[model samples]
Target: MLRAELAGVFRRRRTLGLLAGLAGLPVIAGLALYFSGSSHGHGPVFLDQVTHNGVFLALVGLVVSGQLFLPLAVSVVAGDSIAGEAAVGTLRYILTRPVRRRRLLVSKLVAIVAFAVVAALVVAASGLVTGAVLFPLGRVTTLSGFTIGLPQGVARIAAAAAVVGLSMAGLAAVGLFVSTLTEAPMGAMAATAAVFIVSLVMEGIPQLSILEPYLMTTHWMAFTDLFRVPISWTGIERDLGTQAVWGLLAGLAAWARFGTSDVTS
Candidate 1:
Protein backbone atom coordinates (compact mmCIF):
# COMPACT_ATOMS: atom_id res chain seq x y z
CA MET A 1 0.00 0.00 0.00
CA LEU A 2 2.82 2.37 0.89
CA ARG A 3 4.59 1.49 -2.33
CA ALA A 4 1.44 2.17 -4.33
CA GLU A 5 0.92 5.51 -2.58
CA LEU A 6 4.51 6.52 -3.31
CA ALA A 7 4.09 5.48 -6.95
CA GLY A 8 0.98 7.60 -7.28
CA VAL A 9 2.81 10.63 -5.91
CA PHE A 10 5.81 10.31 -8.21
CA ARG A 11 3.49 9.95 -11.19
CA ARG A 12 2.29 13.52 -10.78
CA ARG A 13 3.77 16.20 -13.09
CA ARG A 14 4.37 18.45 -10.08
CA THR A 15 6.60 15.82 -8.50
CA LEU A 16 8.68 15.57 -11.65
CA GLY A 17 9.07 19.33 -11.74
CA LEU A 18 10.16 19.37 -8.10
CA LEU A 19 12.77 16.71 -8.71
CA ALA A 20 14.19 18.63 -11.62
CA GLY A 21 14.20 21.89 -9.72
CA LEU A 22 15.85 20.33 -6.69
CA ALA A 23 18.55 18.68 -8.79
CA GLY A 24 19.22 21.82 -10.77
CA LEU A 25 19.80 24.05 -7.73
CA PRO A 26 23.19 22.54 -6.90
CA VAL A 27 24.38 22.69 -10.49
CA ILE A 28 23.37 26.32 -10.63
CA ALA A 29 25.06 27.13 -7.33
CA GLY A 30 28.20 25.32 -8.44
CA LEU A 31 28.37 27.25 -11.65
CA ALA A 32 27.76 30.55 -9.87
CA LEU A 33 30.54 29.95 -7.34
CA TYR A 34 32.88 28.65 -9.99
CA PHE A 35 32.47 31.79 -12.13
CA SER A 36 32.33 34.16 -9.17
CA GLY A 37 35.87 33.18 -8.11
CA SER A 38 34.86 32.67 -4.46
CA SER A 39 37.20 29.70 -4.19
CA HIS A 40 40.33 31.48 -5.45
CA GLY A 41 42.33 31.20 -2.21
CA HIS A 42 40.31 28.65 -0.27
CA GLY A 43 41.82 25.30 0.68
CA PRO A 44 40.39 22.04 -0.68
CA VAL A 45 37.88 24.01 -2.65
CA PHE A 46 35.36 21.24 -3.01
CA LEU A 47 31.62 21.82 -2.57
CA ASP A 48 31.97 21.64 1.22
CA GLN A 49 32.70 25.33 1.49
CA VAL A 50 29.71 26.00 -0.65
CA THR A 51 27.90 23.61 1.63
CA HIS A 52 29.39 25.28 4.71
CA ASN A 53 29.28 28.95 3.89
CA GLY A 54 26.32 28.20 1.76
CA VAL A 55 24.44 27.08 4.89
CA PHE A 56 22.95 30.54 5.36
CA LEU A 57 22.08 30.74 1.71
CA ALA A 58 20.58 27.27 1.82
CA LEU A 59 18.62 28.14 4.97
CA VAL A 60 17.14 31.19 3.31
CA GLY A 61 16.30 29.15 0.25
CA LEU A 62 14.80 26.34 2.31
CA VAL A 63 12.88 28.75 4.53
CA VAL A 64 11.46 30.51 1.50
CA SER A 65 10.84 27.17 -0.15
CA GLY A 66 9.32 25.81 3.01
CA GLN A 67 7.10 28.86 3.37
CA LEU A 68 5.32 28.06 0.17
CA PHE A 69 7.15 25.67 -2.09
CA LEU A 70 7.94 22.80 0.25
CA PRO A 71 4.60 22.95 2.03
CA LEU A 72 2.86 23.14 -1.30
CA ALA A 73 4.96 20.24 -2.50
CA VAL A 74 3.93 18.27 0.56
CA SER A 75 0.32 19.36 0.17
CA VAL A 76 0.25 18.50 -3.51
CA VAL A 77 0.91 14.94 -2.41
CA ALA A 78 -0.81 14.58 0.96
CA GLY A 79 -3.41 17.33 0.78
CA ASP A 80 -5.24 15.35 -1.82
CA SER A 81 -4.56 11.98 -0.32
CA ILE A 82 -7.94 11.75 1.32
CA ALA A 83 -9.92 14.84 0.43
CA GLY A 84 -9.15 14.71 -3.28
CA GLU A 85 -10.45 11.20 -3.43
CA ALA A 86 -13.45 12.25 -1.42
CA ALA A 87 -14.06 15.09 -3.85
CA VAL A 88 -13.73 12.84 -6.86
CA GLY A 89 -16.23 10.42 -5.27
CA THR A 90 -13.62 7.68 -4.92
CA LEU A 91 -13.69 7.61 -1.12
CA ARG A 92 -16.52 5.12 -1.19
CA TYR A 93 -14.57 2.95 -3.59
CA ILE A 94 -11.50 3.07 -1.41
CA LEU A 95 -13.43 2.32 1.76
CA THR A 96 -15.08 -0.68 0.14
CA ARG A 97 -11.65 -2.33 -0.18
CA PRO A 98 -11.30 -3.09 3.56
CA VAL A 99 -8.52 -0.57 4.11
CA ARG A 100 -8.72 1.12 7.51
CA ARG A 101 -8.72 4.90 7.52
CA ARG A 102 -5.90 4.81 10.07
CA ARG A 103 -3.81 2.57 7.86
CA LEU A 104 -4.43 4.72 4.82
CA LEU A 105 -3.52 7.90 6.68
CA VAL A 106 -0.36 6.27 8.01
CA SER A 107 0.66 5.24 4.52
CA LYS A 108 0.06 8.74 3.21
CA LEU A 109 2.07 10.23 6.07
CA VAL A 110 4.94 7.87 5.36
CA ALA A 111 4.89 8.82 1.71
CA ILE A 112 4.86 12.53 2.58
CA VAL A 113 7.86 12.06 4.88
CA ALA A 114 9.71 10.10 2.19
CA PHE A 115 9.11 12.87 -0.30
CA ALA A 116 10.33 15.52 2.14
CA VAL A 117 13.55 13.58 2.74
CA VAL A 118 14.13 13.23 -0.99
CA ALA A 119 13.49 16.94 -1.47
CA ALA A 120 16.03 17.87 1.22
CA LEU A 121 18.60 15.46 -0.19
CA VAL A 122 18.10 17.01 -3.58
CA VAL A 123 18.98 20.40 -2.10
CA ALA A 124 21.98 19.12 -0.17
CA ALA A 125 23.33 16.98 -3.00
CA SER A 126 22.96 19.86 -5.45
CA GLY A 127 25.03 22.10 -3.18
CA LEU A 128 27.65 19.43 -2.53
CA VAL A 129 28.01 18.41 -6.14
CA THR A 130 28.20 22.01 -7.28
CA GLY A 131 30.88 22.68 -4.68
CA ALA A 132 32.94 19.67 -5.76
CA VAL A 133 32.85 20.55 -9.43
CA LEU A 134 33.55 24.25 -9.09
CA PHE A 135 35.37 24.85 -5.82
CA PRO A 136 38.66 23.42 -4.53
CA LEU A 137 38.21 20.09 -2.74
CA GLY A 138 40.12 19.50 0.52
CA ARG A 139 40.15 20.70 4.13
CA VAL A 140 37.50 23.31 5.04
CA THR A 141 37.80 26.26 7.35
CA THR A 142 35.31 26.36 10.20
CA LEU A 143 33.13 29.38 10.96
CA SER A 144 34.99 29.76 14.26
CA GLY A 145 38.28 30.28 12.39
CA PHE A 146 39.54 26.74 13.03
CA THR A 147 40.45 24.42 10.18
CA ILE A 148 39.06 20.92 9.77
CA GLY A 149 41.05 18.23 7.91
CA LEU A 150 39.30 16.49 5.03
CA PRO A 151 38.16 13.43 7.04
CA GLN A 152 36.65 15.43 9.90
CA GLY A 153 35.28 17.98 7.46
CA VAL A 154 33.42 15.32 5.54
CA ALA A 155 31.95 13.89 8.75
CA ARG A 156 30.81 17.32 9.91
CA ILE A 157 29.24 18.00 6.54
CA ALA A 158 27.34 14.75 6.79
CA ALA A 159 26.16 15.68 10.26
CA ALA A 160 24.99 19.07 9.01
CA ALA A 161 23.10 17.44 6.17
CA ALA A 162 21.38 15.00 8.48
CA VAL A 163 20.28 17.81 10.78
CA VAL A 164 18.94 19.72 7.80
CA GLY A 165 16.99 16.69 6.56
CA LEU A 166 15.42 16.11 9.97
CA SER A 167 14.42 19.74 10.33
CA MET A 168 12.10 19.50 7.34
CA ALA A 169 10.14 16.67 8.93
CA GLY A 170 8.49 19.10 11.33
CA LEU A 171 7.32 21.27 8.48
CA ALA A 172 6.11 18.23 6.56
CA ALA A 173 4.03 17.12 9.52
CA VAL A 174 2.56 20.58 9.90
CA GLY A 175 1.55 20.52 6.27
CA LEU A 176 0.06 17.09 6.70
CA PHE A 177 -2.02 18.26 9.62
CA VAL A 178 -3.26 21.24 7.64
CA SER A 179 -4.06 18.85 4.81
CA THR A 180 -6.70 17.23 6.99
CA LEU A 181 -8.45 20.53 7.68
CA THR A 182 -9.41 21.47 4.16
CA GLU A 183 -10.50 19.98 0.86
CA ALA A 184 -9.05 22.94 -0.97
CA PRO A 185 -5.40 22.15 -1.67
CA MET A 186 -4.59 25.82 -1.82
CA GLY A 187 -5.98 26.35 1.65
CA ALA A 188 -3.84 23.59 3.07
CA MET A 189 -0.71 24.88 1.39
CA ALA A 190 -1.35 28.48 2.32
CA ALA A 191 -2.10 27.66 5.93
CA THR A 192 1.11 25.68 6.25
CA ALA A 193 3.12 28.47 4.64
CA ALA A 194 1.54 31.07 6.88
CA VAL A 195 2.51 29.11 9.95
CA PHE A 196 6.10 28.96 8.78
CA ILE A 197 6.27 32.66 8.00
CA VAL A 198 4.78 33.52 11.35
CA SER A 199 7.25 31.28 13.10
CA LEU A 200 10.12 32.83 11.21
CA VAL A 201 9.00 36.31 12.14
CA MET A 202 8.67 35.30 15.76
CA GLU A 203 12.13 33.79 15.69
CA GLY A 204 13.58 37.11 14.58
CA ILE A 205 12.15 39.23 17.38
CA PRO A 206 14.65 39.98 20.12
CA GLN A 207 11.88 40.77 22.60
CA LEU A 208 10.58 37.27 22.06
CA SER A 209 13.64 35.88 23.82
CA ILE A 210 11.46 33.93 26.22
CA LEU A 211 9.42 32.56 23.34
CA GLU A 212 12.42 31.84 21.11
CA PRO A 213 12.97 28.38 22.54
CA TYR A 214 9.53 27.31 21.40
CA LEU A 215 9.80 28.43 17.81
CA MET A 216 10.83 25.79 15.26
CA THR A 217 12.72 28.28 13.09
CA THR A 218 14.97 29.11 16.03
CA HIS A 219 16.63 25.74 15.58
CA TRP A 220 16.54 25.67 11.80
CA MET A 221 20.09 26.96 11.77
CA ALA A 222 21.28 24.64 14.53
CA PHE A 223 23.43 22.88 11.97
CA THR A 224 25.54 26.03 11.81
CA ASP A 225 26.98 25.13 15.18
CA LEU A 226 28.50 22.02 13.60
CA PHE A 227 30.57 24.21 11.31
CA ARG A 228 32.47 25.58 14.28
CA VAL A 229 36.02 24.27 14.82
CA PRO A 230 35.29 22.52 18.10
CA ILE A 231 31.77 21.76 16.83
CA SER A 232 29.45 22.80 19.62
CA TRP A 233 26.84 20.14 20.26
CA THR A 234 24.91 22.40 22.60
CA GLY A 235 22.83 24.10 19.94
CA ILE A 236 22.56 20.92 17.91
CA GLU A 237 21.08 18.97 20.82
CA ARG A 238 18.69 21.77 21.75
CA ASP A 239 17.55 22.20 18.16
CA LEU A 240 17.09 18.48 17.68
CA GLY A 241 15.04 18.25 20.85
CA THR A 242 12.86 21.19 19.88
CA GLN A 243 12.29 19.83 16.38
CA ALA A 244 11.47 16.39 17.76
CA VAL A 245 8.87 17.80 20.12
CA TRP A 246 7.27 19.86 17.37
CA GLY A 247 7.33 17.02 14.87
CA LEU A 248 5.79 14.60 17.33
CA LEU A 249 3.03 17.00 18.32
CA ALA A 250 2.25 17.82 14.72
CA GLY A 251 2.20 14.17 13.73
CA LEU A 252 -0.16 13.33 16.56
CA ALA A 253 -2.46 16.18 15.59
CA ALA A 254 -2.51 14.99 11.99
CA TRP A 255 -3.34 11.46 13.03
CA ALA A 256 -6.16 12.58 15.24
CA ARG A 257 -7.62 14.85 12.60
CA PHE A 258 -7.44 12.29 9.80
CA GLY A 259 -8.81 9.48 11.89
CA THR A 260 -12.01 11.29 12.66
CA SER A 261 -12.44 13.19 9.42
CA ASP A 262 -15.60 12.49 7.44
CA VAL A 263 -15.40 11.87 3.72
CA THR A 264 -18.76 13.42 2.99
CA SER A 265 -18.56 16.05 0.28
Candidate 2:
Protein backbone atom coordinates (compact mmCIF):
# COMPACT_ATOMS: atom_id res chain seq x y z
CA MET A 1 0.00 0.00 0.00
CA LEU A 2 2.80 2.34 0.94
CA ARG A 3 4.64 1.54 -2.24
CA ALA A 4 1.56 2.19 -4.31
CA GLU A 5 0.98 5.50 -2.57
CA LEU A 6 4.58 6.51 -3.19
CA ALA A 7 4.37 5.55 -6.82
CA GLY A 8 1.22 7.60 -7.25
CA VAL A 9 2.84 10.63 -5.66
CA PHE A 10 6.00 10.33 -7.72
CA ARG A 11 3.90 10.20 -10.85
CA ARG A 12 2.43 13.62 -10.17
CA ARG A 13 3.72 16.53 -12.24
CA ARG A 14 3.63 18.82 -9.22
CA THR A 15 6.08 16.60 -7.37
CA LEU A 16 8.43 16.48 -10.31
CA GLY A 17 8.27 20.26 -10.70
CA LEU A 18 9.04 20.74 -7.03
CA LEU A 19 12.03 18.41 -7.24
CA ALA A 20 13.38 20.33 -10.19
CA GLY A 21 12.92 23.68 -8.51
CA LEU A 22 14.67 22.54 -5.34
CA ALA A 23 17.56 21.00 -7.25
CA GLY A 24 18.03 24.19 -9.22
CA LEU A 25 18.15 26.56 -6.23
CA PRO A 26 21.61 25.54 -5.03
CA VAL A 27 23.01 25.65 -8.51
CA ILE A 28 21.68 29.17 -8.85
CA ALA A 29 23.21 30.08 -5.49
CA GLY A 30 26.51 28.61 -6.56
CA LEU A 31 26.54 30.59 -9.79
CA ALA A 32 25.70 33.75 -7.90
CA LEU A 33 28.52 33.17 -5.41
CA TYR A 34 30.99 32.38 -8.15
CA PHE A 35 30.27 35.62 -9.97
CA SER A 36 30.25 37.69 -6.76
CA GLY A 37 34.04 37.42 -6.22
CA SER A 38 33.52 36.68 -2.52
CA SER A 39 35.69 33.58 -2.73
CA HIS A 40 38.96 35.36 -1.96
CA GLY A 41 39.82 35.68 1.74
CA HIS A 42 42.54 35.11 4.30
CA GLY A 43 43.20 32.13 6.67
CA PRO A 44 42.77 28.49 5.65
CA VAL A 45 40.86 29.18 2.44
CA PHE A 46 39.16 25.81 2.71
CA LEU A 47 38.15 26.41 6.33
CA ASP A 48 37.81 30.16 6.99
CA GLN A 49 36.52 30.97 3.56
CA VAL A 50 35.00 28.29 1.34
CA THR A 51 33.33 25.76 3.61
CA HIS A 52 32.10 28.20 6.21
CA ASN A 53 30.77 30.85 3.89
CA GLY A 54 29.54 28.61 1.11
CA VAL A 55 27.95 25.81 3.10
CA PHE A 56 26.40 28.11 5.69
CA LEU A 57 24.90 30.36 3.04
CA ALA A 58 23.51 27.38 1.19
CA LEU A 59 22.13 26.05 4.44
CA VAL A 60 20.39 29.32 5.22
CA GLY A 61 18.62 29.19 1.87
CA LEU A 62 17.76 25.53 2.42
CA VAL A 63 16.46 26.26 5.90
CA VAL A 64 14.34 29.10 4.62
CA SER A 65 12.85 26.79 2.01
CA GLY A 66 12.24 24.15 4.65
CA GLN A 67 10.33 26.61 6.77
CA LEU A 68 8.24 27.86 3.90
CA PHE A 69 8.19 25.73 0.76
CA LEU A 70 8.90 22.26 2.17
CA PRO A 71 5.77 22.20 4.31
CA LEU A 72 3.73 23.13 1.25
CA ALA A 73 5.38 20.29 -0.64
CA VAL A 74 4.56 17.84 2.13
CA SER A 75 1.02 19.15 2.16
CA VAL A 76 0.85 18.73 -1.59
CA VAL A 77 1.22 14.99 -1.02
CA ALA A 78 -0.47 14.48 2.35
CA GLY A 79 -3.17 17.07 1.85
CA ASP A 80 -4.32 15.11 -1.15
CA SER A 81 -3.99 11.63 0.33
CA ILE A 82 -7.60 10.98 1.33
CA ALA A 83 -9.26 14.32 0.79
CA GLY A 84 -8.42 14.26 -2.89
CA GLU A 85 -9.94 10.85 -3.32
CA ALA A 86 -13.05 11.99 -1.54
CA ALA A 87 -13.29 15.02 -3.79
CA VAL A 88 -13.08 12.79 -6.84
CA GLY A 89 -15.69 10.36 -5.41
CA THR A 90 -13.08 7.62 -5.36
CA LEU A 91 -12.81 7.58 -1.58
CA ARG A 92 -16.11 5.69 -1.28
CA TYR A 93 -14.66 2.96 -3.40
CA ILE A 94 -11.49 2.87 -1.29
CA LEU A 95 -13.47 2.69 1.93
CA THR A 96 -15.58 -0.16 0.50
CA ARG A 97 -12.49 -2.29 0.78
CA PRO A 98 -11.72 -4.17 4.03
CA VAL A 99 -8.65 -2.07 4.78
CA ARG A 100 -8.49 -0.66 8.30
CA ARG A 101 -8.53 3.11 8.85
CA ARG A 102 -5.40 2.98 10.96
CA ARG A 103 -3.56 1.05 8.29
CA LEU A 104 -4.63 3.49 5.62
CA LEU A 105 -3.53 6.47 7.66
CA VAL A 106 -0.25 4.79 8.51
CA SER A 107 0.48 4.02 4.90
CA LYS A 108 -0.26 7.58 3.87
CA LEU A 109 1.91 9.01 6.61
CA VAL A 110 4.78 6.72 5.61
CA ALA A 111 4.47 7.85 2.01
CA ILE A 112 4.46 11.50 3.04
CA VAL A 113 7.54 11.00 5.22
CA ALA A 114 9.28 9.19 2.41
CA PHE A 115 8.62 12.11 0.08
CA ALA A 116 9.90 14.57 2.69
CA VAL A 117 13.12 12.61 3.09
CA VAL A 118 13.73 12.49 -0.63
CA ALA A 119 13.02 16.20 -0.94
CA ALA A 120 15.47 16.98 1.84
CA LEU A 121 18.18 14.87 0.27
CA VAL A 122 17.57 16.61 -3.03
CA VAL A 123 18.15 19.95 -1.33
CA ALA A 124 21.32 18.73 0.36
CA ALA A 125 22.71 17.15 -2.77
CA SER A 126 22.03 20.32 -4.74
CA GLY A 127 23.79 22.36 -2.04
CA LEU A 128 26.80 20.04 -1.85
CA VAL A 129 27.29 19.85 -5.56
CA THR A 130 26.90 23.60 -5.88
CA GLY A 131 29.27 24.28 -2.98
CA ALA A 132 31.93 21.94 -4.31
CA VAL A 133 31.71 23.33 -7.82
CA LEU A 134 31.62 27.05 -7.01
CA PHE A 135 33.71 27.05 -3.87
CA PRO A 136 36.74 24.99 -2.92
CA LEU A 137 35.85 22.16 -0.56
CA GLY A 138 38.29 20.92 2.06
CA ARG A 139 38.04 21.91 5.70
CA VAL A 140 35.22 23.82 7.40
CA THR A 141 35.51 26.71 9.82
CA THR A 142 33.16 26.70 12.75
CA LEU A 143 31.08 29.69 13.80
CA SER A 144 33.23 29.88 16.93
CA GLY A 145 36.32 30.16 14.70
CA PHE A 146 37.63 26.60 14.93
CA THR A 147 38.76 24.78 11.83
CA ILE A 148 37.51 21.31 10.83
CA GLY A 149 39.54 19.34 8.32
CA LEU A 150 38.13 17.99 5.04
CA PRO A 151 37.07 14.60 6.39
CA GLN A 152 35.47 16.22 9.40
CA GLY A 153 33.80 18.78 7.15
CA VAL A 154 32.25 15.99 5.09
CA ALA A 155 30.99 14.29 8.25
CA ARG A 156 29.56 17.53 9.60
CA ILE A 157 27.71 18.23 6.35
CA ALA A 158 26.20 14.72 6.46
CA ALA A 159 25.19 15.18 10.08
CA ALA A 160 23.73 18.57 9.31
CA ALA A 161 21.67 17.08 6.47
CA ALA A 162 20.31 14.41 8.81
CA VAL A 163 19.39 16.97 11.42
CA VAL A 164 17.58 19.14 8.86
CA GLY A 165 15.69 16.12 7.55
CA LEU A 166 14.57 15.08 11.02
CA SER A 167 13.49 18.60 11.85
CA MET A 168 11.08 18.61 8.87
CA ALA A 169 9.19 15.57 10.20
CA GLY A 170 7.22 17.93 12.41
CA LEU A 171 5.99 19.88 9.40
CA ALA A 172 5.12 16.65 7.60
CA ALA A 173 2.98 15.58 10.56
CA VAL A 174 1.18 18.91 10.55
CA GLY A 175 0.39 18.51 6.87
CA LEU A 176 -0.94 15.02 7.52
CA PHE A 177 -3.19 16.33 10.26
CA VAL A 178 -4.51 19.08 8.07
CA SER A 179 -5.14 16.51 5.35
CA THR A 180 -7.71 14.73 7.52
CA LEU A 181 -9.65 17.94 8.17
CA THR A 182 -10.73 18.87 4.64
CA GLU A 183 -11.73 17.52 1.25
CA ALA A 184 -10.08 20.46 -0.47
CA PRO A 185 -6.41 19.81 -1.17
CA MET A 186 -5.67 23.54 -1.55
CA GLY A 187 -7.27 24.28 1.80
CA ALA A 188 -5.13 21.74 3.60
CA MET A 189 -2.00 23.01 1.92
CA ALA A 190 -2.85 26.61 2.68
CA ALA A 191 -3.74 25.87 6.28
CA THR A 192 -0.48 24.07 6.90
CA ALA A 193 1.54 26.79 5.15
CA ALA A 194 -0.34 29.53 6.99
CA VAL A 195 0.48 27.96 10.34
CA PHE A 196 4.18 27.98 9.62
CA ILE A 197 4.12 31.48 8.22
CA VAL A 198 2.28 32.67 11.28
CA SER A 199 4.74 30.95 13.52
CA LEU A 200 7.61 32.63 11.71
CA VAL A 201 5.94 36.01 12.00
CA MET A 202 5.25 35.46 15.67
CA GLU A 203 8.82 34.38 16.26
CA GLY A 204 10.02 37.71 14.90
CA ILE A 205 8.11 39.88 17.33
CA PRO A 206 10.34 41.29 20.09
CA GLN A 207 7.57 41.13 22.69
CA LEU A 208 6.73 37.51 21.89
CA SER A 209 9.49 36.25 24.15
CA ILE A 210 7.02 34.15 26.07
CA LEU A 211 5.53 32.63 22.93
CA GLU A 212 8.77 32.08 21.04
CA PRO A 213 9.76 28.90 22.82
CA TYR A 214 6.43 27.33 21.89
CA LEU A 215 6.80 28.19 18.22
CA MET A 216 8.17 25.44 15.99
CA THR A 217 9.79 28.07 13.76
CA THR A 218 11.86 29.17 16.72
CA HIS A 219 13.53 25.79 16.83
CA TRP A 220 13.68 25.26 13.07
CA MET A 221 17.10 26.85 12.90
CA ALA A 222 18.49 24.88 15.84
CA PHE A 223 20.55 22.76 13.48
CA THR A 224 22.57 25.87 12.61
CA ASP A 225 23.95 25.90 16.12
CA LEU A 226 25.57 22.55 15.42
CA PHE A 227 28.14 24.31 13.25
CA ARG A 228 29.41 26.30 16.18
CA VAL A 229 32.71 25.48 17.78
CA PRO A 230 32.29 22.88 20.54
CA ILE A 231 28.93 22.18 18.88
CA SER A 232 26.00 23.20 21.08
CA TRP A 233 23.87 20.14 21.61
CA THR A 234 21.60 22.02 23.99
CA GLY A 235 19.67 23.90 21.30
CA ILE A 236 19.55 20.94 18.93
CA GLU A 237 18.28 18.66 21.70
CA ARG A 238 15.57 21.13 22.61
CA ASP A 239 14.61 21.50 18.96
CA LEU A 240 14.41 17.75 18.46
CA GLY A 241 12.39 17.37 21.65
CA THR A 242 9.96 20.07 20.59
CA GLN A 243 9.66 18.59 17.13
CA ALA A 244 8.96 15.15 18.60
CA VAL A 245 6.21 16.55 20.76
CA TRP A 246 4.64 18.35 17.83
CA GLY A 247 4.91 15.32 15.56
CA LEU A 248 3.26 13.06 18.12
CA LEU A 249 0.44 15.50 18.78
CA ALA A 250 -0.17 16.07 15.11
CA GLY A 251 -0.08 12.35 14.35
CA LEU A 252 -2.63 11.68 17.09
CA ALA A 253 -4.86 14.43 15.75
CA ALA A 254 -4.64 12.97 12.26
CA TRP A 255 -5.47 9.51 13.51
CA ALA A 256 -8.43 10.73 15.51
CA ARG A 257 -9.81 12.78 12.64
CA PHE A 258 -9.38 10.07 10.05
CA GLY A 259 -10.75 7.30 12.25
CA THR A 260 -14.01 9.15 12.82
CA SER A 261 -14.24 10.61 9.33
CA ASP A 262 -17.23 9.55 7.21
CA VAL A 263 -15.83 8.24 3.95
CA THR A 264 -19.02 6.58 2.86
CA SER A 265 -20.38 9.89 1.60
Scored by TM-score, the top model is 2
What Cα-based lDDT does every candidate model obtain? 0.66, 0.71
Model 2 Cα lDDT, one tens digit per residue, 124-212: 67777777666666556777888777666656766766676677667777888887887887888778777777888998899987988
Stretches of candidate 1 exceeding 4 Å from the true structure: 39-81, 87-91
User: What is the lDDT, from 0 to 100, of the residue 228 in candidate 2?
Assistant: 79
Residue 204's C-alpha lDDT in candidate 2? 86
Please give the lDDT score for candidate 1.
0.66
TM-score of each: 0.79, 0.86
Model 1, span 1-265: residue lDDT tens: 7898899777878888976776665566556665675655553323334634443334333433434455456556655666666667766677768678777777777777778667766666565555555555556677787777766765665566567656666666677777777677666766776777788898778998899888876776677678787778988788778877877888799889877776665
lDDT of 2 at 53: 50
How large an RMSD does model 1 have? Answer: 4.5
